[model samples]
Target: MKTKNIIFIYILLLSFSFAQSALKIATVSYIKGSCYIENSIQDKSITPLAGNSIMNNDIIHSKEDSFCDIIFDDDATKIHIDENTRVKILSDNYSRVFEVYYGSVFVSNAKTHIKTYIQTLNNNIYVNNNNIWVNSYRDFDKVVSINYNANIYNYISNSQIILKPLTAYNIFSNGSVKIDNNLDLVPDYIEDESYLQVRKENRNKYDVYLNDYDLIPVYGRETEKRSFDDNGFKLGLTAGTRYMNNNEYLTFGLFPQYKHNNFIVYSKLNVYYDYFLKCSSFDDCEFTESGIYSNWESKNDILEKFHLRYHRSDYNNSFSIYAGEIPQVTFGHGYLVNKFSNYYEYPLRSDFGVNIDWKIDNDFLNFKFLVPSIREYFRDGGIFGMHASLFLSHRFPLTLGLGFVMDFNQFSQSPRVYDVDSSIDSRQIKAFELDFELDIIRSMNLDVSIYGELVGIWYPENIFYFRSDGLMPFSDDLRWRRGTWGVMAPGVSLLIDNKHEINFAFNFNSAAFYPSYFNTNYLYNRSLYYLTAQPFDFNTLGFNLVGNQIGMLNDFAINSTNMEFFVPKELYPILTNKINVFPLRGFSIDYKYNFRNKIEYYNAISVYTQNVGQEKIKSQTYYTFDAKLSIKENILRNLSSLNFYVSNVFFLERDDREEYTFGFNMMFDLPSDVYILFDIGQVFYDVSLNGKRNNVLNSGLQLRLNF
Candidate 1:
């Protein structure tokens, strides 16, 4: 009897050894379209078939419109690969492991007790006897728990979070995590006919257990799950009317878009027809050459947008390029160019622009480039800028950035003569900036950083020639220097919960230097002159001089006798502060303040700030406050979305008037994917003389249909 028992034990040991030797990680159970397997060892690619064995480090890739299913050796564990997905099986240990580089996948371990791990760039998810959906992208990872709980481990923060059923977690590239609850965990693609057929066949052939909820057809949920696919063509039409500057225009536009994977082509064509109306009284016939009317007079009235964009990203790197009508561009703290838009005169004037951004090794290095207006480049000259940042170390979280911007011709859009006999040469203005940021504290809920920027601007010599002696022209050294420098140092930035942000900085500059020279109002302020010690004599062949006073040219002047009349303007140091708060989704408040010494300029070209009441100089403050609310999904029926914004600007020292702008936009959803958009706004412009302002009333309504 002892010998018989020994023989049975030996047989059992031998069987266990055989099972371990022939262990298979997983098997490809179903393939819908264009699915392939890549062998990591051999570097070979193969079109996979049903029953194909999946091994460690085998990469599974599904092309566009293609998907596949894999079943583990345990039979109860499975994964559904979505279109345009790439995943790798990393290990065949007791706890299965897979890494998702990009795209989406559905993991099913509902009927098995074995633990499964899904890893992404930012976080790792562990599941056991639970089904979950995971979508990984270059900058973020999204996870949804279907029926059971899962645990997400953030490697960066060293935190573990429990993901309950019907909950979604979004992990950003910066290691910040956001959680949302009460969501539908099932993806819409699972209900596709091909996927359904494959699941049905697999259930019968392999006798896999699928829940009733997974097999049942879902209806009326299509709208909630609607999303753009990899390939599509869509066209939208717009019909609107606008009233500005006592003139009315009927606007019509066509927007066409085509997308294929990471490449997209978009174009917009707009036409504005002048609408004539008979005036009943002389007071009703006020005419002004401002706003849209000026855009028409400039003859830039046809194409609004035409661009090709290509974007692609993975866990380690990303690249994107846009060639056409870039809406906005900013570089490095916006010291030189901030919120500069190529479409400043949209609907009437259009610009061709190019923007490129590239990131390597997950923010180890980043590069950005922008050409403000390619169309104007060859004709008149344009602005070109590039910025780069390098992450020094992860432990310290310090970043160093360099930026350069060149306006090939600062006088491109200015009047040719500028009341001078000889036209000014194409003045090339260049700016260089070096910035550094060090994070004092970085956490999931709060972030604090201190940054500084040292900037220098170079202006071309001979901005304007003045008569030093009879017929001998020389540049004014005292008035216009060749170069100037500024510093924005010891800036503090605070962020809370990824929703509220506050920034405070101290800016000091030389008299000739200007911060944020190329800003949102650059187009309007480009031609304005700077203020000089004395008012320019129109009889002499000299250019106008202006100073930077927010959006308007400095009108203050100092009078002096003799050629020694030029006095260097004492630059006032500024304190800049900004705050942005988002109390809820789609609602935000933004406030910005620029505080400086209140300087009074005398007719003798002297500058001084009053210090009568207190030892400190009096303060001149310019502030802008804006509040916006956008609601897309609300309890109100027929109201698809509503966007309302109110903005006010106070330049009390310069204009002594408050500029208020407010707009209300609403969209109503109709049948057949059609929508109606209505908008009305009151915009203020610095059109009147003597630092006065005028308000324009503009309203528009449009119909859009998208497919």
Candidate 2:
């Protein structure tokens, strides 16, 4: 009888222990050093031992160089805390809620049904795919990594960034973020089976899968499934017509593409025929000018584009190589190396080169080297360009950038002329730029950027490159030239509710700090609204003040006469050979309001002024205003759209040069993938032209087929 009573008591005790454990949300599975647990409900703090039960509202602190892991019992969700980190478990019901104060944490919840919520100083991250890592740096930057797409709302910057699969993002408090592919701290790569066994032995737990390749799919599934048939054939065509300035032309193009798993090949031929250039017979046909050919498609008429490209990457995206033509290349917000071309002036442009991207454990690096030249006009004149960027840390990342472009003609002793000849001396036009970015306010949203560039002509004949206005003149002389530029900008950003944001920066530079020929100065502000269901809402409004200066080496003889700010040495003698001393000011204000569920509207206004010391150049007050409206609908089994646009440009002190343009465009997309477009426009140049009822008509039609 005594033995039976003892057995009954033992069973009751076991049941009680199991019930208590079930009530706890999580337990400290592993610990390294200096980990403390604070219970807000109890108003008490204690050092947590491994296997200690933890409930909601429990704050965990990992001191310097310490580490700890918390495992939720209901699901196998695990949270790893890094050194100098504080995290509080707000709730752990159907979803887990965590607030990270500082430091880094890695969360891996492979259970698809489990959801995780992380709140940082500036952003809130929603994790639904189970693989995620978060780092809060000094409360100013929030950096995260995930294996799949996730939603992140930045409250401080009023913005959202869709975290793509196998990508890392460094989000700032002001809504500015940098994106990189396939980089993770703490080695998120899948462990080998042997490694998992060792982990299980060491921690007394075996939960994580060793072969987690699907956790990160390099290039995604579409790239893997897309393959070519035996013929490897695809075709596209576009035909268009235009009537403008008492002239009409027909434009047509044919494009053929071959796609495969490892490589792609394509070619395009475009031609435009002018009605005035027609001949009575084929033998009597004549052409005024020949079109240029390139390795990439030309935006202008009469051209051919032939390209071959190959790419390969691993599942985790540790290595990737791209060869052949790349259409667009931009660097560091286009401060340097924006290779997009303006076909109106430069009809020929191409990027023929190779790009390499790799990651070493935690560090990420990328390099691109290209020959930015047209293929048909090939020459051995020696032109090359390269750009590279590197990141050391995802949180408080130290980023470095470098770019260079060199040409052999700019420094030639022989005077540059329109005609090509053997007399042109072979000298190097060496240009290089270096930049660094650092987050100074570790706990706030503030960053400082510093850059230096030297895009100058090197004269081999002259040992010294600089002389006074009297000794050497730039417009006439070809001796030593000065071309050094520097820039320093400090910026701050603020956001509210992840929907509204404002960014402000003060820029000081020797010239307008854009690597491209046409670019806006610093202090430029713009707003954006992604189209959504509610179209009648006012989406964006912004204003900006800008400062500008002309650089010393602004004279690129190729098109110097056509550029507005390209001041010859003789025109601005005092401003030569200087750094960060530009004397120009500009400001702009813009707003957009969308109305009607089926229509979109946009409006903007801008103004610019020049300052020569204390004097304001009244003649340089350039003003511009633009407005556009668009509508889309389904009509007669076809997707149809109509667009209207208008722009006006004037000067504050002048009226003769004022210009206005009005345009209307229509498009129809058929069910068979054929598209038809038509555009008509009238340009009224100046008030005199408008008074005389003189307007130039410009109209065009385009037809395109795709399969």
Candidate 3:
């Protein structure tokens, strides 16, 4: 009887402890669409029904086009979960906390005695007021106080901030913060009628109590409601006149856009007419001299921009597709292609393009595909490629990727000039790359990744080599046929607080291959080989001289009338480095460096020998710098923004002249939904390789109206 009594008392105490540990902290009062609860202990998820119990450490997830309301055990405290939101509940003796992993949540704490805390990826928000909203995203976190005040603590910078009523605060991952005083710019979902109704019904049913506080103004609510009601169809018209070099032209454009949910359709139609080409009568006009009239000669002009875009993102999956005019495209670490664009020559030419991107489970698998010129693809050959990356593990992820790109017909751009020989066939160019990356450190403010890539470029045709044949150079037999390969090893990437990024890599290439072969300038440089190709002159081959090539030529002239020139074969032990900085909201800077080596031969002998030339290695370093500044927020009265950019390039030994470009653009807001825009640009280059340089200046002024 004594043992039985003791066992009974022990079991009774255990049961009571279990009951305390499993106490319900909240309940799902209302749900619209699919809502799920994830059991923290079992690691399983189940559809949450009405009045579902939410215990400590339980996670709630709301799917797309869904929302839910949760009534806490306090009865006076409640929360509304928006679509695509994940929240975890934590309870303690002192307070109840909601950990928002991503998405947005609205909290209404009517009781002043109860303490409510909202934790995010980078911030800990303590709600001291009656109504507030919190949002956490991959790149930033945001907080808005509707009726009262809140205190926020940043985990990255270890600082605290106070959020006042009718204010919004945005905290970026880089430890930068932006504050807005206007509540009208808040997300539209927060003001949805359905969500507000659900919150009201839940409060009434639960018999929640509220303390008197300052209420929002009637005019503010009316303004927000009117803004949403007026967001239907928008059309913009722009009329401008431009002066280039000594000629003037008229420009007119129409921009129409429509967006609903995750789908959007946008179109731009532009017309340019030369001032000198206009005549009193249509019959007197010369269509050949008019830019607008001549545009109809090509089919590409008709499809300038009819862009269609669709994007959808769920808790663990996202997909986006775009058709028409892809401004920039890159694959992998950009070993073979980087920043390739089809809109390089916007007004002068255009290309229809397509792009698709898909990501699953926080980059566990990422895939991308692109077509540079869809019209050219059907008419001739075009550029196409795909890239895919797979992450093996969630913790300590080791990522591997494969990339492939092909130019079906390299000569398709100018077929007539390249079809010189029948025997030299196969104008295809293809590249293959295999890459791997490992993250050494990933934290809230800093990330470091180490990566490497191996790439190969193939050309089916034989290599054309110039060889000396007596007095003149001649094309050698088409015997040497091989592919070029390159390697980028020991690369380091550093991202600091999402504001600054730095990259450094060591590149090695064989005889004929180069890194970033298909880059921003690929469109214009693709057909350059045809003009520069020449037969090798055997008589000009010579050994190294003690002085410069010009001095050596003088010596050669003193000895003999014939002169020899040094020819170099490019080889690599290349070093590349790039840095991008975003120090402020509307300002950025980018710079890159390429250090390369070239092998040269100097004349040391009177006659040509098999291997008697003095070999020399020279350094050719290339540098490019770009900077931009744009002010969108109103800093001055009636001045919308003043934007400008400057870019400069130093080719070192590659070119004799340096290149520079400058552009400026400004916008001013006028009365009655009207705006005035002014822009100017200048480009300096030596197109003919002569000593004289050419400067191209362009300026434009326009008036825009939005309706």
Candidate 4:
């Protein structure tokens, strides 16, 4: 019995020794998109783990499922996991190390803090784990981080290992073992000096990253960039009150857009009523709505929330070149055409137009036209062009600062003419202009332009018995119309620069509309000349304080005309043109001073005439004031204001008695990104007579929520 007991005691000690583990243990199960297999079991390196496996510092296991043939992408490069392999992410989200048990895998060594366990022996390699870890010995002259608490391990290197140059032996074992804080018997270090301090202060700085590549949903800036891989879309709204006939009414608007690549399909609709809590554009926007995703990316729209009240288009589907219908009216970067808010009166001001822009060789060609076939059906069709125009614009390097614009307009098709002078059958106007862009000095650009025009008339009423190509013969039954009559006008202008130029204009009037060189703002007779300004990026403050004001001035001086009424002529030129100085281009500077109502002095130059016809012998000027300014535009807006004015006039007869304006009024705007709009408008009197003034006000308001 004593002998048996002794045998059992010895067996017990042997069992205890065999059971002791070198590290902690755990297990994991397989999920989707992976497979596992068990193959070899030699030196514990070839053993396969399946269904729920775990380890710590010693024995290792595969990821998730026991079987392991996995694929991962990142610092180690695209790695292919062999059948039945075991590896470990030894470091937690707070650690910077990974551990590989044993297996054959392809690894592409990369230079990044985001690293992998399969160390690089060369630029590239595929290994079976025989022995391939760089010689990370002692790191004598290096300042490396050793986060024992975080990594659960440390580095150890002796003089012998350091001297080995490029070699490492089995680490941490019994018998000939000598340990001094060395992990995997390997020395780890970093090239940075303050690494240790950084690791100590920040715990999760090294958190292992897992993204969509891992089969789970993730969100971030990078994720956002990927979401809109194709074209983007925005379902927004546009609502605002339009002042007409001196009355105020409520307005509601909606705008939705779908964009793919550069192709766009957008539509807008607006409804109106009257008087609420101060009226503006869009009574209710889906800004704060729930469920929908509102991103800074949505605002990524190159253009901002515009007053889109109708369907408008500018691009055309065409080959490199095509002889399109209505070959005239070429375009160069202008969006939208209704310059004034009072479009109800100018019903035919819209146009069903198409534009083509293509560049080949060293020349860039662009052309556009309005289709006469589509008429009143298109709420946005302009009738002015029913007459005619043939425009051709070209850019050349043949001569320095030398370019030309040729345009031809004729009353080729007279379907209907409500107003006509029986003197001519059909009239045609043609002009050709040349410009030399010269840089006299840095930043001082000068475009010297010279052009001549030819106006030919066809007579439908004449005294002859037969009609000549230039004349229509008169019969007792049919009155004769004149044919083929003509005139020529030439002009020149000096532009300091292409961008917001300091301009000077000198034109000799001859025909109604001759060439574009004489167009005060390049705002009309687009038949030639093109002016384009880059839009401001959200991040670009744009000349700091001149953004909103820039748009307003351009709207009037270059693209849209302004109105100034109520201030008398004695104070007109001084209060207006003096302040506006010469709005040859869309640019303005303002100055203000006032001391109570008794001594009120207001001066403003709002570009009022888009065009003054050469034939309009009766020249005139009437005072008018109506504008909207807001801070929501990102800068330069304060004390929302709405004021009315009545003034004298100096016209064809230099009469001071023929002008007046009474309109609706209200004002307001918000901080950044929020809209606050105001309107003060009305048309009191006209017709080369006396002056008058009328004023009215209406407003409304509604909070918005984004979608």
The best candidate in terms of TM-score: 3
Q: In order, what lDDT does every prediction score? A: 0.58, 0.48, 0.58, 0.27
Would you estimate the TM-scores of all the predictions? 0.55, 0.44, 0.56, 0.31
Q: What tens-digit string does per-residue lDDT give for candidate 1 at 628-678?
A: 565543223456767675543322243322234466778887767788888
Clashing pairs in 3: 468-538, 473-536, 473-537, 543-602, 543-603, 543-604, 544-602, 544-603
User: 3 or 4: which has the higher lDDT?
Assistant: 3
Task: List the candidates ranked by lDDT, beginning with the highest.
Answer: 3, 1, 2, 4
User: Could you tell which candidate, 1 or 4, scores higher by lDDT?
Assistant: 1
* Best first by TM-score, ranked: 3, 1, 2, 4
Pairs in clash, predicted candidate 2: 156-495, 158-498, 465-480, 509-580, 510-580
Measured over all alpha carbons after superposition, the RMSD of each candidate to the real structure, in angstroms, is 16.7, 19.2, 16.5, 27.2
Worst 10 residues of 3 by lDDT: 575-584
- Cα lDDT tens digits, model 3, 1-707, are 99999999999997776565467888999999999988655456789888888877789999999999998765657889998999988876556689999899988764333457888888887764356788788878877766445667777887555554444677776666676334343556554411332333433355432111112111211111112123346799999887754457788989898877677778877677785665669688753344552454556656756787888754346799888877567777766766677654444446678888899865479898988777666646688888899987645567998989998865444332122222222256788988888877654345678887778888754333222222322223112335777666667876553335566666555544545566654543353211111222322224211222233223212113222111111110110011010010111122222111011111110110122123232222333344556554234445677766654432223232223456788889886779998988765432332323456567889999988
Tens-digit per-residue lDDT, 123-174, candidate 2? 8887643456778875454454444555677887665556543334677787
Instruction: Report the poorest 10 consecutive residues by lDDT, candidate 1.
Output: 575-584
What TM-score should be assigned to candidate 4?
Answer: 0.31
Where model 4 places Cα greater than 4 Å from the true spot, the runs are 1-231, 238-242, 274-364, 371-373, 377-500, 511-673, 679-706
